[model samples]
Target: MDARKVEKITALLISAMIVCLSFSGEWDWQTVGIYAGSNMPERLLYPFFHTNMFHALLNSWCLLSIIFIYDIGIGRLLSAYMIAVTVPVDTLGYFTTMDSPTVGLSGLVFALFGSISFEVLRKRYYQLWMLFYLVAGFLFPGINAVLHLWCYVLGLIMALLNKPVKIMHHER
Candidate 1:
């Protein structure tokens, strides 16, 4: 599918998840990944729900921007997020903490940020000065800097494999 179509579908899906998560408190455990005994599917669910509207919006904006800017397909976006952020978090959280639940889409957003940042730097696109915004997460003290850093590194790996080559024409 095209990037626009993928973006629209993503927006709709995220909106629905946000509404469902907001109204259903009991379902929080279902959407958010907990440090419980092995439940493999929970890894894939981490990106769909958030702690609050602000958290959802933060992730949604990052998601949309990455999709639109790089024209990343839905499958690529979903696969990268699940593999880069969700799976590792789920596996590690289980062994590390057995009670606290990790809830938020920040990991996915960090991956996106990392992908774009890596592509920009690797290509030496200095005119893309907007990369300075990468530190935007610094404003939010609650962010998982460690998790984000790991996911970002994974995103860079993904970018290297995918190679952002579709947009052959750079803006002059």
Candidate 2:
């Protein structure tokens, strides 16, 4: 399978899982924290749990859109990098807060904002778009605006420090 195709399929599967979570009503906000927190045995485990239907739907939409965009506009590696940054930040939020349950892919969305900002900085295009992302990050309600801000900052740092590399480039 082509890498891009795999990514698209993964995005769709994730979105499907989100829809399932929306209907399951099994995992609550606190339960999601347990799976996504820093104390986890592995970071890969966090993406499985969610808070509610709304949370799942919001994250699913954002993840699918971002992955789709990154896969096309940037590359598969960058899309994976965005997801990598997002998961840790999502977990970190759980660890940092005391009884404050964190859920959703808002952190990843913020990371996308950061990545886009980096692209703008590198290419000198989309200044207005970046500004709009910042505005959206701040203005969006019920979406961890603070986490988004921090993740954006972190993503900027990652983009600056790390050289772009293509991962999963070969077809499976």
Candidate 3:
């Protein structure tokens, strides 16, 4: 199968996961934090929980959309970069705010914002898409808004420092 086909399937699967999660109907913020936290002394095969079905579904949808767009526009490398950068940043946020107990994909969304900034800068052209992304970033509200902005700035820097690759070569 082609890369595009693979990406489409991935997007669909992620979206489906989000939709299914939304209907699970289990919510617990503190338990989720303990499960997903980075400071796990014990080795558990699975260590993550959700505040509620809606929370999982919402995050899954956000993640799926970000992955879909990243695959479509940039390719898997940058998508991986975004995810790599996002996890640490988000984990830091969670640890720092352990008292608050936060759980969501806002961090990943912020990573997407970072990816977008990179795209806009590298292309040297700000089209409607960039504007839409900027607006979306500004309008979206969550504890990680600042984190998203910081990651975006960092991503832009990463993109700028990295040499450009031929996107057309991978085009189907």
Candidate 4:
């Protein structure tokens, strides 16, 4: 499939899931939120839902930008997204003192950003921006900085492990 099609489809599907699930009350804290002792299903599904349309749209925009800009392959995009969502929940869910359910694709967005940062290390802004965002998120209310950090690390590791080759072309 074309990269453009994959990017559009991924973004559309994610936005659709958030919108459709929002109407069904799946965003309710008790229903689909991730927390310590939550079932596996809740941990897996919460990332596809969000607290509000604005939250969903913000995440969607970040997701779209990363995939389109990097031209991330479908396999890499899906694998990273799933890992970003579930891994942080399992690892960090036990450590949080939150009174509400956590939801959003910020982790996935950060993961992609991290991957891009690793793939193109000369562009230092990605790492710097991630650090700035993490600090900002920590100071903000209701933001999960730890999860973002974890996802970013996971993405960097993914890039390191894959070590994708970039073929350079020179004009004759």
Q: Judging by TM-score against the true structure, name the best candidate.
A: 4
User: Any residue pairs clashing in model 2, and if so which?
Assistant: none
User: How well does each candidate superpose onto the true structure, as a TM-score?
Assistant: 0.66, 0.62, 0.53, 0.82
Clashing pairs in 3: 27-51, 28-51, 114-152
Each candidate: how many clashes? Answer: 0, 0, 3, 0
lDDT of 4: 0.75
Q: Residue by residue across 1-172, what tens digits does model 2's lDDT show?
A: 7777887787788689767766876654444543344454234334555667777787788777767776433353355445643455555554344344555555655565566554544454554665666668557554455565666676666566654776777777
lDDT of 1 by residue, 45-135 (tens): 6666666677677666766666666756676667666754444554555334335456667677666655665555445553243343444
User: Candidate 3 — which residues are off by over 4 angstroms?
Assistant: 34-37, 40-99, 118-142, 163-172
Lowest-sum lDDT 10-residue window in model 4:
88-97
Pairwise lDDT winner, candidates 1 and 2: 1
Per-model lDDT: 0.60, 0.58, 0.50, 0.75
Cα lDDT, model 4, residue 102: 78
Worst 10 residues of 1 by lDDT: 126-135
Clashes of 1: 0
Best by lDDT: 4
Cα-lDDT of candidate 1? 0.60
Model 1: runs farther than 4 Å from truth?
Answer: 1-3, 26-31, 36-38, 84-86, 90-99, 118-141, 164-172
lDDT of 4 by residue, 46-161 (tens): 78778877887788788877766676877778777787657645567666556677778888787887677665646677677778988898787788777888888888888788
